[model samples]
Target chain A: MNPEESLKFSYYPGCSVATTAAESNHSLMQVCRLLGLDLQELEDWNCCGSSSAYSVDPELGFNLSARNLSLAPGDRPLLVMCPRCLHHLRHTHLEMQQDPRKRRAQERRWGRPISPDLEIVHFLEALIRFGLDRLKKGAARNLNGLKFVPYYGCTLFRPPALRRQKYYQAEVENILTALGGVAVTRTYNQRCCGSFLSAVKPELVTSLVNDIIGSAVAAGADCLVTTCAMCQLNLEVRCTAAKRLPIFHFSEILALALGAKDCQGWFIRHLVNPRPLLKDRGLLGPPRLGQVP
Target chain B: MNSQPMPAKTTEVINISELDHHFATEVDRRSQADLKRCYQCRTCGNGCPFVEAMDYPPYGVIRLVQFGMRQKALECATIWVCVSCHTCSSQCPNSIDIAAIMDTLRSMALEERAVIGNKEILAFHLEVLHSIERYGRTHKLGIMLRHKLLTGQWFKDVDVGLRMLTKRKLDLVASKVRAMDEINRLFLPYWRVKPR
Candidate 1:
């Protein structure tokens, strides 16, 4: 596939994106259609093990993620929507290539000769690779003056040297600007939101997410946009009402600007819905009075 | 028997340089992180979310490893408490991966049969693994329920759990993955390697 002019790639919608952040999945679907991006989800893919595997069993984490890569078709680079999933897949890819023992284990499990040739790219990477000029020209509605803090919660950019080449450090900011949204620079963008440990230690997550969201709110962001599903979840479930920062998936903002009309269900799914802010800004129409169900 | 070695008297001139010499090597072998590369710069702890909660901060963990304080580094609640954020790894001037070290410590604790300080968090990890073992995915509610039952934290997160359920975030039932047996096979090595 041509790297520059191509939009088609196999999509791996990580676990959280399907359940907790289903809105992200909905918005991503709409955005892909509007932008002419072809995202075919990998068939029969399993979990990437996330932080759970890394924190508990290193071996399980590697094998579980490698299993997914093994299942991916080599024809197209696997485009992942979640940063955690992207990191795990990519990290395991690196490990399996470098470690002879792990490489042997991976090849044996899959019953074939494996290759690190499986390219794993994050949504941000794909969008950035998709070209910003096209995004600006293709936007159906301008998100001008809509201040957004691009909250990159680890994964994609962290462990910097490993991710340095593949990821553009300012890619999220670039995407927001291209879509006509003002990216808040002063806000704490690249920080960890305690990720999945939020389930076990909500208090710790609350403090961490509070600081990240507070920075955005203080910087006058209308909403904090994130590419990570876990970051959105942590901010939604942990942050206090006083924080008043509605967490949004980057797909939601782009999908809206691309004129996604259906998916009121997606908007309502947010713990603190972004519609009121969008409606107030004239970026989105008023909520329709329709059936509750 | 206590796992720790006897501490030398403060009044005596203690030549402890040779003591715990193998600590750094053992941690290095497991973590694939060179503990000696750490220069006591607390950059990792500065960015750590759990530093206040940890007995020894990120740099302190490496320092402990450097001094061969295995009991100090491995038996504490910090390993369980760490979110594996990799903030330390990213910021480390030496490129020392603190997250990997934390995982290594957790594995060491489990292997050594050390008394874990944070049973609640431990229970949560075990329950999640158990759920994955059965369904081949981390069944969130099932893991939550099992964790609550195991830890007796029934009242914990009930409000949030209820809210998620009402919001339809929780998929109460899901079809088991067809290759669950394959996942089970993966766990076989984990079960057999334990000396106990």
Candidate 2:
């Protein structure tokens, strides 16, 4: 694929980004638009059988994910933002590839061709493949040496089933650094953020989230930029530490650096308001009268 | 005879006849993880973030499975506590997919109607699935409300819930897929209609 040409992808926002992390979705669209990446939202995409479906019933999980695959247009690669969604979609795709009978059965069920060769790529991977040159050329506002821990959460690249596939360990650092952000490595960057347990067992999640935030604060980082929207929510909502750092969806920072004007809308949604930190670093202007300070 | 009494026995003896010898094979087949390859190095347990909350560590659960302790393995809290973060599997020297095995055990436990090790977590998952079944997408507010109602923990996490609502993070209305029939059919095979 040509770096200069606009890349088209079928975007799968997943459930979290669609609802709870709407700001992330907004910022993601902003970033993609600035980069000239044309994202067509996957038509009528359903939930990817989140951790819940897979936990109680493996067959339900498989079928749930298979339906999303059936909906993907064979012409373009499916671009997913959430790591868990990416994992399930890609894992289901791999399973279908290995078992032709299952693939055919699902295809027949959906009355759509489940493409054997459809490429499932994460947004980060898509950026690496086609946006690096665009990022360097189209960067409007530098990151102002903003120090952030590139928190990939746990599911981004750690799953054993997808081990042999693409490894995205340093991709966040690579992209953010190119935009002038300083990457903080001396922290618990890849720690699990307690996932859905944040909902049921808030105490447990609070302790775990505190540990993660404490590590980041001790490491002297300004904020955490995460690839997963779920991690962003968990970290923001579950932390009970004395001092808290703002958690950013990776696309928010990317969109900010690209000179997105609607940043207030995005920053306002954060539990730990990032406006003050952004202002302190000269990344954002002083708030207007009556605006969130 | 010596006057000193024998120390109280701390270990429980397992009756070999009760062990399900095919349990390991069933898990292996479902999870696609080679349980036989696991030598109990304890790496998975050591790396698990939530191991401290579990009744048995990841390795201990694997040991139970290896020993065909089906009832013990199925009812363990480790499976429910695990969020499938894959930290254990990634750190395993033998490359055992310990998270996958945990997922399989959780499913088996649900299927066999074993006592749920963590009912609250299971309740949360059920609410999430229920939300998906209704709207074809998860409604965070709905899931939380239903979960709270089911667990009868209305006051717990109320502050965070309200905070999320104030921040407009939790959508009141869920986004739905246009193809509801397509999604509902997928859930038909396994989802038993439970009174909400």
Candidate 3:
């Protein structure tokens, strides 16, 4: 009962999150609520514009995105689960901070001063910061014999944009370990999944998705867990051929470890059914086939 | 009627209206500084793994855009061909954000009904976006079925599907709608407005 000891954060579920990774936001909301973490959603936020804007017009892209950064309600740090949003926000912050003139011009465009008061941290980092011991004790199901591939994609470390970092892979591994799952670190973990290719050249995406999936599958990982919605969608949906291998969002796993049954309630609708792996790991009780209940 | 060949001097007069200001606005909005920096070194094309199959290599399109030849640039398959790996941005000596700009162009092209070549790919993107709007996260089989149905390419990829099926790859079910109401409330507004 020391409720005061439980940490709370402001949640930012980006565009992809509200649409494509709804399960992640849902699961995160439920699991965090149960864990006594308070997450208040910001009001009237726009798309981070992601990597898309950087290539078109850097200033306008950053200005539009900076307006979003300016709109976050109050001084608390923003908790982001999407890696794309993380990259956008962090990159925007770094660029704005590095150049005073650019920052001032961006401020003029946004009609407001964009202060770096809010520190953006990924959910995986939050799990570690909250301490793995607590997460381990909270697990209702010990994920025994469950092997997973941690798909980092390209966002975790890129553009040499941010410093003050710990070992990214180790951080993710530590969190997974606390949840009773094993992480299989592989070369392709940090590689590109040709995420934007899903739009224009899917044949290329299909082939690239195959390679990323092949690497994970070959590494003997039963599924791929990631913090990026784009990576999750690309790996799970683009591989029309290998759709059986589930790609669980990190929020889903955290929800599971927190003993929230709602994850299973929503799990039924997952593109790639996770029952086979969950059953083998004893994560789900009994065999419930083709049933959301 | 016998057609008169245009004089060389007249050919030099560029029609600026054909430049696609909408696309230019989008590109300028996204890659303002970087777009002018591209110099057609073919580094972007050379680095792109899919360039060999593309109708217009990426670098050439940048050159076309720089020269303000709108129709020719927009008509090419370069935007559709880019994989958005950032290899070009990483390798470019001038710091051009080529891949991201390409994404913006595709988004604009999608909006203007200007899309050409790779109809199947366009269908897939729309399918995935639609699925997310409907269920708030794509269901693999649903996306595949929609993409295949819309493109009439279902049977074409059946071999890939079969191999995956034999290997226990494809799943036959959809994801659970645990908090369907919340998902609906959040997603409905965007679809109502339609993407621009």
Candidate 4:
């Protein structure tokens, strides 16, 4: 239990983090590395079936998540980034734990033993468990009193399926406040980001996103930070409000505070362009040559 | 903005003979939620963020299931419109897990070939599943392109699409799982074999 010793975790970055929210993935990696956490990507891991698989075929979604569980080595906790992925994985695990017959059938299907005792921890929980002191020691930059709303995007602690488990109500605020950022508590932090509706019903999602961003702006916050990558994407892409605040993935701000240097690449991927806000707060340096303004 | 008219409450008389008495039991078994405990407090409906878009509020859908109105429960736009954000479930005084009930109702709708209340939403989901089936992981750019083709709304979100492309948010190549056969076998269930 040495604080400085790197803790090993099998990381599962769901679809959004891998592609649409790669900046989150990049920043998460940067933050983890800075905090001396070793994240080994789960090998040959497939989709958790996302909301679609479960929506169309629940059994398919169950098996898809079970496959990822079977792949994880039981020795260490499996780390998940996406809130939806974490829910699906943990729900599947809970189901398997309740029904031995189902677990045995899945184990036979994959030809690998599914460990019932494997701990599935979200990145936020892992940071709280192992990285607080490390965060204190590794603080490389002041947050300049940057005010941000901790938007959990409806899935982190709301799902009834996992209600008995950990509730991450103020974990984001605690971590960021420790880093010198101010947490704005009056905004719509847990509002739905219109998940898939952002694509099918853009107008509806536009209004919802506008309401969320509008509330944040009204709360006198500098920006919004979210733990879920999909929330980050939906908030950025669907906002049609006359006033918009840049949405930062929790990892981006965490990485910036920990002195991650290659953040220009992450900032360029944002549609809202958080550079001005970062520059105003003095969290980011002045634009370098060839950097996007 | 595309909200449907609120469902007629009392204009439609309930024909008890037409009720499928076993529908509620089936949903209860599948979802493992205590639907019978819902006292119609409307706490769920009140807390639902997307209730404006749904024809029936969360409790109204529960009532449909309770009344054994199978077709109404399965074919209602509320089930499809729900993104399973669990706002209702969390706020429900009865702890009924309303979102799980919606999930069960959606799957049952697909299984029974009931008319889908929202075809576009179902189409978007199918595109995502198809991408997962092929790559073992969802490919955002591919899902979006194919979804546009299926819905034939290619020009609707073209600006957002272009913006994402410029930001390099969409990866051209999907990250695939190394074990393709194992991932493929999960889709062998006949119902899912034919991607709609």
Best by TM-score: 4
List the TM values for chain B, per candidate: 0.84, 0.89, 0.76, 0.91
Instruction: Please report, in order, the local distance difference test score of every candidate based on alpha carbons.
Output: 0.76, 0.87, 0.64, 0.88
After superposing candidate 2 on the true structure, give the runs of residues whose Cα lies further than 4 Å from its correct spot: A2-6, A285-293, B1-9, B189-196
DockQ-based class of model 1: acceptable
TM-score of each: 0.90, 0.94, 0.64, 0.95
Selected candidate, larger lDDT, 2 vs 4: 4
**Total clashes in model 4, counting residue pairs 3 or more apart in sequence or in different chains:** 0
Model 2 CAPRI rating: medium
What is the DockQ score of candidate 2, to 2 decimals? 0.72
> Cα lDDT for residue A148, model 1?
87
Q: Taking the candidates in order, what DockQ does each have?
A: 0.47, 0.72, 0.09, 0.82
How far off is residue A160 in model 2, in Å? 0.7
Residue A178, candidate 2: alpha-carbon lDDT: 88
**Which candidate, 2 or 4, has the higher DockQ?**
4
For residues B75-178, write the lDDT of model 3, one tens digit per residue. Answer: 57767656565656666777777766676666555556664656655556566555544554445567767777776765665755564454333455644334
Interface RMS deviation of candidate 3: 8.0
As for lDDT, the candidate ahead, 1 or 3, is 1
Q: Tens digits of per-residue lDDT for model 2 on B1-196?
A: 0022222566989999999999999999988999889897877776777876788888889999999999999998889989999988888888989989999899899889999988888888888899889999888889989877777888988899999999998888888988788777866653653333
Badly placed stretches (over 4 Å) of model 4 are A1-6, A286-293, B1-10, B189-196
Candidates sorted by DockQ, descending order?
A: 4, 2, 1, 3
lDDT of 3 by residue, A1-293 (tens): 24353366677777667655667788988878766677777555555655444433344346545656665654566778777777777777777677867777766644666675556777776676667777666666666646888777776765433434432656766777666688888736766777766644567677767877787778888888887888887777678564357888878876776677766665764667788778767677632333211
- In model 3 chain A, which range of ten residues has the least summed lDDT? A284-293
